[model samples]
Target chain A: MKTNKTSRAAQAFEKSLAARPTGRYVLRLFVAGATARSRQAVLRVRQLCEAELKDNCTLEVIDIYQQPNLARDNQIVATPTLIKEFPRPVRRFIGNLANITGLFVELDLGAKGKIAV
Target chain B: MKNNRPKSTSPVVHLPKCPTGIQGLDEITGGGLPRGRPTLVCGGAGCGKTLLAVEFLVRGAVQFGEPGVFMAFEETEAELKANVASLGFDLAGLVQRKKIVIDYVHIERSEVQESGEYDLEGLFVRLNHAIDSTGAKRVVLDTLEALFASLPNEAILRAELRRLFRWLKDKGVTAVITAERGRDQLTRHGLEEYVSDCVILLEHRVYDQIATRNLRVVKYRGALHGTNEFPFLIGDEGISVLPITSLGLNHKISSERIATGIPRLDAMLGGRGFFRGSSILLTGTPGTGKTIVAANFAQAACRRGERTLFFSFEESPNQIIRNMHSIGLRLEPLVKRGLLRFHAARPSLYGLEMHLATMFKEIVTFQPDVVVMDPITSLMDAGTASECRAMVTRLVDYLKAGQVTSLFTSLTQGGHALQQSEASMSSLMDAWLLLQDYEGNGERNRVLYVLKARGMAHSNQIREFLISDHGIDVVDAYIGASGVLTGSARAAQAALEKAAVLASQQEAAQLKREVERKRAALERQISGLRSDYETEAMELRRIAEQVGTRTFVLGTERAASGILRQADAKVAVGTRGKPGHGRRN
Candidate 1:
């Protein structure tokens, strides 16, 4: 067990060195209620983050109807707004995550979330 | 201009009114801004837009019993509180009472890195939260256009502004949005597009080194507003607008009479005095006692136990008091009694609007029963004649509406007669008392006459207005051969008349004596003639008696009648010859 713990610590250090120093992406999605558009945005964003980011992103979905304080805190005007909280510059997107590539480009994540097309 | 015009031909929708409680502002807006809609107040720097917005919220909470939320984009809460403290607005107390909510939204251009698209949604959410929390019926976004300076995208700003206005309308809360005036534009971003319900433009212009602030309602959607640019003031009582032409001819009339200080002048006006709440114009040339008349009016008002407000443009309070003391008007006592208030300012100290606003503010605060404006003509130096007229008209209207007597003294330029100047107040005044310096009998004497007094009988005679130790004294009308006389001429003419009467009396006495002497002389002549005739008759009587005696003797000698007859015949022939000789002679 001691040998396995030592190997795991060493592997984690190497992994941290291998990954980019910018760290994982942090994002928040705001919506009015559990409407179809909100659900689609949530599902699509989660799919893209898991598929591309691969456990390298933290996502929080806030329903303005329920947790309006959070939505207000984030300056959410319209439903299904995506806010990129990580990185040096904060960015905003005001639509459902239909065009994943365009969302990545707007969020300054170049080609990271691009599909095989 | 096109936006200002009503769109529909149908009956206009009467928007609900919200009284601003800013004195004349409500009247100018025809009952305050269109209710529950955004009103854009745009002005240049230091034109009082922020003060107006803040006053809106403050007055809403204090006077109207409506809770308000002030979302300042420029000034912080402490700054605003301190700024408005002098105006008697206790913002902190209001906030503590949950009657007001202030949220300062600071925008740091350098700190805000505009890397992606951003909207003013943050401001909206905060404002909405404050409004909801406070249940505010009024909202003020002071200097809202400051966001435009911080943000880089105009398109986004405009869209957000449009949405914000729509949201405010949907919320049904009276909102005042202040914006910076653009060059040749009502607002920097043309915010007038979004706030279509009402738009007020404030202008601060320095004319001849004197700054004058004016406010005009550029567009009021469904209300009949005063289109003229009114003068507004941010004074001890915050924003107060002075409406130039809103005072129509609908003020209530009072038949109550108030005495003028001079009893003689009062007699000239009528028996009692000028009508209560009437506008009296005292116009004259320089040194015609306009100030003295105004002082007397104020003194009389104070003596009547009515509060009086005197606005002297040409003289300071102390100077006026001292000068009036010479005329026996003891204004110091009245002032000490708190019955008279003097507001003295140079006409050049401010623009016409400022003067009007200050006067209005004093009137409102003092709540005087009568107002005296000395030398309103001095205000003509601050603006055009029409502008002065407008200001004076508004003042008169305000006083008339409140049933307060107003006396305005204007200076006439030239000559003794009251000339029709540019702003001829004769037609508007209820009573026009013209004072002129009549040069007659080698002396210039101040003469007073009532040019017109509506709905009352006034003395038409020109009175020699004299100032003595007993205050104003108006001598009786001195009608003479030439016309109405005044000054030393009246006195000299009166003396001449007395002398002529005395001379006529002496001449009558002398003629009477001469006629008595003539009658005595005639009587003497008649008596003399009578005596002479009596003497002559006595002589004739004696002759007749002798002749009779002779005839009797001759008759006794009838025997010798034949000889006598022959002699008588010769005598008859001789008599006939004597008669012929006498006829020839």
Candidate 2:
């Protein structure tokens, strides 16, 4: 499980590196430890950054258990909280990132073609 | 911790407690909130729930030397600091000193979207980090119910909250969690369900347009606590809860006596005065000089270099000073000297509890040796009769505990009701002086007498209470066949008595003069009779001489006076001898 987490973290880092600098969306996902829900939220946000907003998003996932100070500084109350840091306006999404359309609409991302589940 | 246990038949395992350092709060909670556990403090909006939580943390940090972490869900750090600063809490200073750490948890529902299962591990992490950074032994989550409004999933929130409480318990830091009062439950979000070791409910109630804040401990899992609603107020320092019946009757008493300002009045009261550290009740009818008596007592106390505090419910401080000045009581000088303080407020200014709290505050701040409440009956109008009695009882108990002498003036309507109204309060007093009005002989007079004086031989004679420019003077009221006479009637009676004495004195003098004249006349008459008797004796002597000469001439004149005298003597001797012989025969 530890190796899998490291590999996923590396993939997300590569994806953010490949994203273009211009009009890039800066995002941070706050999750608790290595729970399945945290893993799902991490995977979902990374997939959205890669599939929908390709080469235009930088996503960083932080485990509150590992970096509790950051959680305190950001006032993170719920786990799996996704924060849009660099967009013109800061926004936050709590809970697992399950509904893609709803997330896209709330993030002010223009309505795009529906992606297959 | 073991010393805090009650000596009862229950098991001896005592619950450890963390002192809140709030006045009168620790006594009510038996020590304080259950230690190393989350206690729920629920109240309605603007009911001082947040302030209580903040005070708990601040007191813990500052007074108990226990570093605290305040995690505010409703207010930010700046806002909380500004809010508590009004109560004189130096939040910024505490924060800078590393004694307290404030973590403002901001969760905006409109700016967030919930998609799936979530836990409050983030909160746990933040709380843990804040506590660890400051090495805090105390934590406060002010109004954690804000999460219920921010989080959409109740099932997940409840589970996370439960786990969060369990985690906090395991962490072993005493925590205070504030929640909004619910309609049918202890908290709006049922936060009490999880943080159930102790629950404190704060209520703000209005009676007769006056508001009173009350606090009650609803439950304590393994401890004994006060279940009655105690009145609490947010004073300049912080929140102070007043436990009505907590003060026991085991105060050290003083045997020293203090004089009433009126010398004669003091004479009426055991010749010395009221016992030190005793509760004195002064009851009177309207315009019967109750305030004057109270002022006298206060002045006497001040003169003795004792700090005196006078609470006037009907008059302002300036008015009392001016009025007392008219009666020759110069309280201003004593006040300037700081030995006397006058606190005046209308009875209707606030609720009875508020007045009591203010009085307690004043007594504490001044630490006066003597406290005088001028016309305490006016305060009865602010609350029920029973409430007034309870207030008096608590006040007396408090004053006694501090070894303070208290004098309470009660205004009676008049007539027989005078004793009836003060019957309830008089029992708590060590000395009770009653001032009454006597209306007769076309005048009204004030009379004073000691009705009761415990542990002292007090006078039962009613004295005519006189208030003049020189102050109070108690004189004996005239008790004659016409009943008790006062005012002009007493003076008239005195005058009549004087006149009767004078008339009797004059008649005795006149009879003495007549006896002197009669004796003088009798002496003159005796002198006249003596002169007449002397003249008659002289004439008799001359006649005898002539008779002797004539008898001598007639008996050949002479040989005469002697011969005539011899013959006469012989005749007289013969007559006497014949009379004696006849008597003998």
Candidate 3:
């Protein structure tokens, strides 16, 4: 019964992601030096998507030292910059994720859960 | 038609860094400083160096909703918040919201030792980190000049200023770096040498027995701004600049004339009345019944069903109305009828511009056909002579544009109330009415005189009037041995004249007849002032129509068609409801 439930959840997530024309909308947070603030921000975003979004949103975390070129391409001015990739008008919000409302507004992830799972 | 295109400074497109919305700062800068460059705000101790810088940052964060960074050189986080809470700004809330980033760098000058040539790299890094962290578009360097005192080397200080300004410019953040301005031009440390964008000088001067705060824009590189010495006042609302004078001699105006409400006054302009939007100044010393005269005019308009607004800076509405009532002019009925509105407030509530702005706002909101300022001199407490002049001049122009008839009362000093010195206000007034008190022969008499009425026939000769429980009454004066008689002295003088006349013989009959004829001519002039008051008043707007201002030297007038109409109207209105009809309408 547990295996069946896990497979069912995976199938639901995969179906929603595949239905989108761009496959899925992804937000990548590229952080440098892994500051406690940055790590907390990543965990906060992940939990916010799970408890808030449930599974409709997808968040990807990146260490800039692992890929310096990605940081440059996205014009990351500082640590912990969240890049909204799927939206036609791309925007970046840089902070330690202190303002959740500002982050949520910029990322376009409201309670309606418009982002692909 | 001019095509205004931005002259491209660089290939990079610039986003408008949110406006600070401070009053004088915007006006002096032609709209605000260069969008993202660090403009240094410098001044001496107790000269508002810190407050202004903080105000700039706070205004950006709160008023304009722009994220800002305040790098304090002296104040702590708690101290800064406590200091600004008095201004009704929630500085702590803004900090908690992450909309503002304040870094209090406490570095004592004596403790820091620099062994080698070093730039302000660490400070720049921290500032850049703050800016990058919050995406702040506005920055304030409160007293960066203190660092010069802290750091021993002059070369490093100057270099650091250049580098810091350049970095702020490159990041495209509008920054303000406060410093201590020196007696010489530019800052003491010559930061003005590094930043070639803008420099403003704030100064306080006491001249002609008045402490006037003035703002002088020493330079603004890429903008056109008012280069004159602007009178500024710092109060609860911060600094406000006085109105700008129209150096241009021409402004298109409406040729309409409206009634001053007082029939006799309207007659002074000829039967046609005053130009719809002209400003009439009623000047007199204290207790000369200027308020009573203005109330009479306003009440008349209210009786006529036209909206009238009374701005009393000297007296409250109830006080003014009650005082006028003591003299028998019932202003309460007019106020109750909803045609008259009085707005009373202290002049100190705002600076001159704000006062004018408030007046203009009320005027616009009420849309009154006639406006009255009970004592225009009340503005003396809020601003300097030049500022008051500019404000009054703007008010006149604005009223004329809107076609609202306005009356202004000024309190003049010294013994001469009839021809009181109106050097600061005379030029803007279309009609000048002088009220005075004359004491001679053991009695004090109040005399009312119209010195100058532009474009109208007026009574140049002073007239006698009485104030009683029944209001103002125009009566015959006792022409005694010398001075004009009024009130009780006039009564005694009249008795003496009658007694003397009863004793006169027939030999002086011809001389009396000649004098009577001349007196009749003067009476005819007065009557003509009433008769043509309306008709000639219609044509009396010599203000703009004249080729140039032909200064009417004293009391002389050319009788016109409406002058007779005005005389008849006054005789009719003055006796309209009187117990016994005094004159033939």
Against the unseen true structure, what C-alpha lDDT does each candidate score? 0.79, 0.86, 0.69
Minimal lDDT window, size 10, model 3 chain B: B553-562
The 10-residue segment of model 1 chain B with minimum total lDDT is B110-119
Order of all candidates by TM-score, from best down to worst? 2, 1, 3
The better-scoring model by TM-score among 2 and 3 is 2
Quality of candidate 1's docking, in CAPRI categories? incorrect
Winning model by TM-score? 2
TM-score of each: 0.69, 0.84, 0.61
Which tens-of-lDDT digit does each residue in B136-202 have in candidate 3?
9888887776677766667766776787788888999888777777778557867653584666666
TM (chain A), candidate 1: 0.72
Provide the lDDT at B252 for model 1: 82
Q: How many backbone clashes does candidate 2 have?
A: 3
DockQ values, each candidate: 0.06, 0.55, 0.01
Docking quality band of candidate 3, CAPRI definitions: incorrect
For residue B355, what is the lDDT in candidate 3?
A: 79
